[model samples]
Target: MENVSTRRSGQALLVWGLLVVAANLRASLTGVGPLLDQVQADLGLVPAVAGLLNTLPLLTFAALSPLVPRLAARWGAERLLGGALMVLTLGIALRWVPVAAGLFTGTVLIGAGIAVGNVLLPSLIKRDFPTRVGMLTSAYATVMGGVAAVASGVAVPISEVAPGGWYTALGCWVLFALVAVLLWLPQMRAPRRAVQAVRGHRLPWGSGLAWAVTAFMGLQSLGFYVVVTWLPRFLQDNGTSAATAGWLLFLFQAVAVLTSLAVPGVMRRAGDQRVLAAICSAVMFLGYLGLLVAPGAAPLWSVVLGLGGGACLVLALAFIGLRAQDANVAGALSAMAQSIGYLLAAAGPVVFGLLHTVSAGWRVPIVVMCAAAAGQTIVALAAGGGTVRPATGEVPDRVPAPR
Candidate 1:
């Protein structure tokens, strides 16, 4: 009885540790947007360079994801995750140096750290809580979204009061990463042999289902990151105060948190998630259209976009697990999907910024967003309906292939 109780205690600690780590993944990145203007002024960043703050991370995620599985194979996911937390902590702290070089360098470090966590967490969930992937994915995603919302909401206020201003507000996230590192230490001692054994299967790059999943991941990320990068500026342009705009961003993320917690379980029981995907696409489209047509209804549009974006995220991650035959395949698929997906997503903010710069209006950029929504709806439908064939490594024709 004592042994069982002790094991349960350990398990509980692991879950908590994972949740804490998840919370840190996005807070550091999301916090930047709320204080972007301050950072730009302080660092003397050009608009093009300012856009790099968000784009660089997505580029890093694309570049690093395929390589992480190999690192996990050699070092074990737990040890790698702990190391990532350390890097994240260091990155967050480095931002306090108050120089343009320090800011960009820290952003790179933060992105690298997050890239590892982003790819590994789904695999970790598959390995540690195989039976509870949906529930745990939802839980961690919720925590991640919630903390991100809080980080966005509080960034300006924290900047206003912190001794080092925006830098201090950005650097403060190191505390969360530090705690995650400490809690994750115990996991580093876990046996690495299992991770090594599963490292042999090549990712099915040729599979159509794989590309569908990749496209779904990419389109959703493109939309989400564009919003994350620009929504505050959009609101501010329309005469909203910085604090109020920050809170609206928070509301957008908070609504996402709720939907992330609910969407996976709801979809898991359905025969196919294409309908859910359609609904999500519609919500996002309407939100964008609302923004274009009725700038005054920002609050309603924010919630609509948040719900859509969050549901799309849950579905994307869930598909990584649900479509795979085993954890190894899941990991491989995750790497491929994320690598391709994020690279594609990296263009979103840059392109959106360029469109606005060229046209001198939000209308053109928003029309692009609406087109992305339509494409996401179509891809999600295909991805949601496709199935993986373990024997030949092909996607069977349950869903029509994207032409």
Candidate 2:
């Protein structure tokens, strides 16, 4: 009875922590897209150099991800999470401090904070809510996407009205971090052994299917970040007003908020993720087509892309749940996948911009993204087999029964 009560209490804390952390994930990531032009103009950033503002978070996520699990292992997950949130609060606060260097410096700090949160949350979910991983992951992703919608949608209007201008607009998100700080304090205070778990323990990364899962996640993220960083500019190039472009980005995040809830449940039940993967990639392809063929006529298509992309992101996380047979394995695999995968994904926006610089158009980059989608579909088929091979070398799909 005592164990049961303690387990329930831990679960409650886990859910609350997930919600608070999820709300902070995307604010720093997506908040600036709407205000990039304003920042560039105010700070006199070179157009090409301004692109790094969007790229910095991805770079930070990639570079910092491999360190997260080790840090969690050494310090305990709750303390690490709380400490990361402190970094996030400090970072978000710096953005409003009246210097361009502070702006860039703060953005880097925020990205590093978020990267730690990103890697740790999956381990927490795996450790605490093992059976409810899908549910918690879906809820967290939904909350994340919804907050992103609010941030992207409101950032420009907030900037227009704030006396300190875009700096104040960007600073508003620090309050979200502060909320996370308050909620996370108890967890930090909780006994360390209560939450600590062994790290660097997981399934061997030797399986073809495991590698496929990693690549699918990496490729899908590459395409998603490319769109996130460049889509508003893409719309502006086609003569859409800045506010409308921001709202279109909002539409993307908004649709993701819904799909993050719906698609994970569907994939959980359907037992075959291949079809869902195909549908997701298709939606993304068509969304880009809408941008190319008729920018204004069907904004809904872009929303669909958001739905699909958000679902893909959630499902990638879900793969860790569905694929792992235990928490230690899940955390280890999650670290491997995210550490290498984010590094690959980090290249997306920078490469997309370089392509545009050379081709002087979006068409070539669109082709590159489409090819990535095709690759995702193939890997999705392989990983969707719903097989979990433990560290033992047994092959589940093609093995005869043990004699």
Candidate 3:
């Protein structure tokens, strides 16, 4: 029993440390959005193709996510995460090079680096913070969301003030990656214990529940990236200045940070997340309605949307951790969800752009997102029922027939 207590204390440290590393994951991507137009104009990219720039990262995430668990199992999670951070840092630093190929390669590497981190984090929480999975997960996710907001919000202004142009603004995130690498360094060198996960497992990812979780996570993420990548431009098209649109996007992301912090705590206590998911989708619906009908008051509606969307993001991640019974299952589920989810998310900006081009307005895109959100609400309800999976380490002797 005394040994058990000591192990718990060590797990706590690891969980917190992993959270700090995860917090740095999204800043590099979101930080560049406000400066994308500047990049497009300066680099001679077409506006339509500019949307591809945002979607490219998601595509890489989808393609790369499936490999993280295999790498983690063979090399160990700490080593993989630490190595990915180095790759991520190098990728960020390289984005400033003069060649267009550098931009594309750097973006892919960044996505790949983040993909590795994304797959491992939930598994870490499942392994380390089993009891407080929801709260710890929420805390890290909140920090992730907040840092991303700050990066996106300040990118333009910081670029104007910095000497290296927008490259300076984007490159600033390399410091965070360095910090993650520093913190992660100790873990890599530490001796493995019986308690620490040495390998991740393979699961039949095509199962019904897995697919449901994947689609729910993916579709919701699709809506989110769409808004994050294009909402500023949407506002600009609707007559707002670029700076104001960026701030409004900032406001949207800010509210999401708050919900990411609070919603998981509440849902964990509530002991279910279906209602919360539905409510989140509804909030997104209202935000879309406001944006579609009254473009001027986007600040107000953005808060509502961000709140719900952030909640969805946190809950989606929490569910991934909770639904799995062990680090391996968590890692597998995380990979499957992200593989499918990021694919869904990768479609957002490009599809939204295509839809906008056809309709010559934001109305059609808003309508499509609303429909997707409503469908997600139903999936969340099924996922929240606490029946899709049993507790960790208790896989059924025989697989039950699919629903």
Order of all candidates by TM-score, from best down to worst? 1, 3, 2
Give the per-residue lDDT digits (tens) of candidate 1, residues 43-135. 888867987887788899999998887887777778888899898888898998899888899999999999988887876676566667777
By lDDT: ranked, best first = 1, 3, 2
| 49: Cα error in model 2, Å | 2.8
What clash count goes with each model?
0, 0, 2
For candidate 1, what is the TM-score? 0.92
Give per-residue lDDT, candidate 2, residue 192: 71
Error of 2 at 308 (Å): 1.5
Model 2 TM-score (2 dp): 0.90
Query: Cα deviation of 125 in candidate 3 (Å)?
Result: 0.5
**Clash count, predicted structure 1:** 0
lDDT of each: 0.82, 0.76, 0.78
Error of 2 at 208 (Å): 2.6
lDDT of model 3, residue 295: 80
Task: Tell me the TM-score of each prediction against the true structure.
Answer: 0.92, 0.90, 0.91
Q: Can you write out model 2's per-residue Cα lDDT over 240-302, one digit (the tens) per residue?
A: 787787778778878777888887568667756777877776667777666666666546666
